[model samples]
Target: MDFHLTPDEQAFRDEVRAFLDELLPPGRHPSDPEFLSTWQRRVREKRWVGFSWPREVGGGGGSIMQQVILKEEMAKRRAPALGTCFMGLAWVGPAIIEYGTEAQKQRFIPDILDGKVQWCTGYSEPGSGSDLASLQCRAVRDGDHYVVSGQKIWTSIAMWSQWMILLVRSDPAAQGKHDGITCLLVEMDSPGLTVRPIRNMSGTSIFAEVFLDDVRVPIEQRLGAEGEGWKVTVSALAHERSSIAEVEGLLRKLDELVELARASTKNGRPALDDDGIRRRIARFETRIAAMRMNGMRFLTKQLKGEPLGADTSINKLHRAALEIEMGDLALEIQGSDGALEKEIDGGRWQRFALSWPEVVIGGGTPNIQRNIIAERVLGLPKD
Candidate 1:
């Protein structure tokens, strides 16, 4: 199969690159909360956040390959990955398009694209992380509203989000763990809702502990059909895996590592001059190339209107592993300085070392990805 971009696509890629050149910040800034906010504002001005989405819902309505091109070019330029509106654009927006009502889309999509509303995901509960189907957060219907009561942990950017896309247990006695679940679009400012920041080892409060004490959501806020949350969640996970934003971010990290290796020294010579270091970097480059090809293949499938399936688990696993490996290589190049605290010289290497753990753990654990590969890809029997 041909894997190259067409002439028109290439022209579009160049156009996107030129646009990014004008839009992205000039100097290097660490991926901190403040930087992210600034990046989001810039993205809003340029209208680059939802390039893959349809125009009717406040997007550019570009093809999936065009979206990939946009992300690849952005990453190649070291543009910021996590903008302020990422949760809304990357996860919540797609979920709404797939499962939201016409009224819901009209009400929320414009605000999302305009950067007037930010969304945070409410999937992982205090008791459910990887085993998300076991979430016990309950939402009982009360007249025209649902009284939601439960807590979600590791909610990213909850402090800044105006709305949330949540998964809750609407029925307790369903036959399967996946049954009786419902997805809801909730206003974060609703009564009885609380968001408390959870500080990470990196000395940043990016994630939060969210509490819902009888938070009332209107019946219309329910996404998909009641008791169909598992289906909705599966679709959401597919979107998450297919996210160009994350893949682009990983590619950018790889590029940054290459630059670091070229500049840093080891044994009285440039680190890139060392055979071992070169081999390691070469291996990572190969892996990243494979990842790019895989991502393109996925995008091609999307363009053909094929369903995104178990194969996405492979993309998630490979991308996550490659990211961690890139970080490891960077830390190796930094040598002793890699262990220094962030306060010491901004802890560049140390921050990467500290941040590595969450890369595998955040979206879904590596083991979970393996399980998906085993069960879905290999058709292996479950324990």
Candidate 2:
């Protein structure tokens, strides 16, 4: 497939860049705690939150290619990502469009696009992580609502979110594991809903533990037909893959590492002068380039309306592994200073190293991705 962008698409890229140049905060760090609100406001101001969505849904109604261009430009600048709403705008929004009733769309779509409401995924529980279908969160039908009661762990940004797209067990017992599941749109303010932050090595509360105790959700809040949560989840995962769009950011980090190495001293000489360091940088650069190409291929398939399949797992696995490797290199370059808790002249690398674990475990574990590749891509037998 041809990899070049048409002139029109190139112009679109420039437009996105200029818009971001004006919209982005004067200075921001990817690790900043308040970065989410700042970036969310800018997205609202630019009206660029839902780039590829339909105009009727409070979006730009732009093409998929335009969306890809927007992500690339944002990454090139190393600007903070659009925050945890990535899932809301890309996955939940699209899912609602496909499966929600007209009233649901009218209520949620505008709030999502305007950044008035942030959302979190309530899929993983203490007992269920990769085996999501075996979730135990129960939702029993009451008079005018479903009374939900369970605990969700590792919910990203749930503490600050206004809503949660949750997967709960509507039927306690069914023939198959995937049966009896239902997707529910739950308001954070609902009675009996509580959020507790979980602190990570980065010294930040990036994820949370969400508790539901007889929380009532209206019948209309259900996303699709009952017992079809598996379908909704699969569709959400597809959108998750499309929205990751972080390959360019990874490349930019690699570029920063190169400059860091050039300036870093190792045994009275620049780290770039060290043979081992040079080789490591070269390998990272090569892998990052391959990742960019892989991302482009994924985008092309998406443009052609082809299914993403297990290839998304491949991308996730590679990208997560590379992030850890880059973090490792950063730590090595900093030597003893890498272990520092706060920013010293050269100690901030420790933060990068500490944050690597989250990237690996966040979207899906590497082992889980491998399982998907084995069963779906290679057509291997399941254990």
Candidate 3:
């Protein structure tokens, strides 16, 4: 695949770079509340938040390559996120655009792009073993509403979100693995809904267990048709997994890791000067390059209208391993100082080190991704 940007793409890249330069001057941090507010407003005005979506729905209607260029430039400059609603922009918006009613699109897509509301996904179940198809959360049709009951585990941002895209089993006797499943756009404040945060090893509760005891979701809130939940979910998960495989974010992390090594001491010398540390950093760079190339290949396939399948698992697996390795290396370089929860670097390295489980297991586990690659890509017999 050709990595070279076309003339139009190069022009777009220049425009993005110029915009970033004006928005993020060298001394100003992107995180400042004042700057962030202005940043979000400006980006939204430019319609860069949902850049790839249709312009009719308040998106930029930008080309796929242009979207890539925009993200690449933004990440390179460490710009504030294009929008405030992470999950919404990442998957929900796209899914809604594809499968939602006109009313649903008008009601939800604008809020998602304008960052007016947060959306959480209710997919995983406690004993489901990551097989979303087997979710036991049941939602039964009752006149104009569906009364949802059962629990979802590992729901990210459930406590803070205003809405949830929930999946439930509407039929237990269906013969197919994915049959009887339904997707509903549920209001978080529905009477019977409850959220309980689940603290991880890092002591953060970004994930939660969501319990719906006869929570009534209006029939109109259902995304896609009944029994079409699997299709909608598969599309949403594809968007999610692709976002997880972002090479630009990994590159930024690599840059930070390099700086960390240069500033830290290892056995009486700068950590960056240590042979082992240097080799690891080099390997990281090489792997990042491989990821970039793979990304370009995926882009090429997308341009050709080919559906990306098991090949994406390779990047997902690489990202998980790279994040773990980089986090550990940062701690190793910091040595004993890394153990302090509130030391220099603001415990950034320590936090990163402890945050590995989410990345390693969130979208899909390393083992799951490897299984996908082994069976689908390599055509190996499933065990």
Best by lDDT: 3
Taking the tens digit of each residue's C-alpha lDDT, what string does model 2 give over 189-246? Answer: 9999999999997788889999999999999999999889889878776666453357
Better of 2 and 3 by lDDT: 3
Would you list the rank order by lDDT, best first? 3, 2, 1
TM-score (C-alpha, index-matched) for candidate 1: 0.88
Candidate with top TM-score is 3
User: How many clashes in each structure?
Assistant: 0, 0, 0
Q: Could you give me the TM-score of model 2 versus the true structure?
A: 0.91
Predicted candidate 1 versus true structure: per-residue lDDT over 1-383, tens digit per residue: 88678999999988887767665657746366676676777666556667667777867777767767777677667676524467777778888888899998999887877778779889998889989999999999999999999999999889999999999999998999999999998999999999999989878788899999999999999999999998987777666635456666666676778788888899999998999998887887777677667777777777788876766777678777776777777777888877656533477766776676566688788898889889887899986
- Estimate, for each residue in 124-183, the C-alpha lDDT of model 3 and write its tens digit: 999775676888998888999999999999999999999999889988888997999988
The pairs that clash in candidate 1 are none
Clashing pairs in 2: none
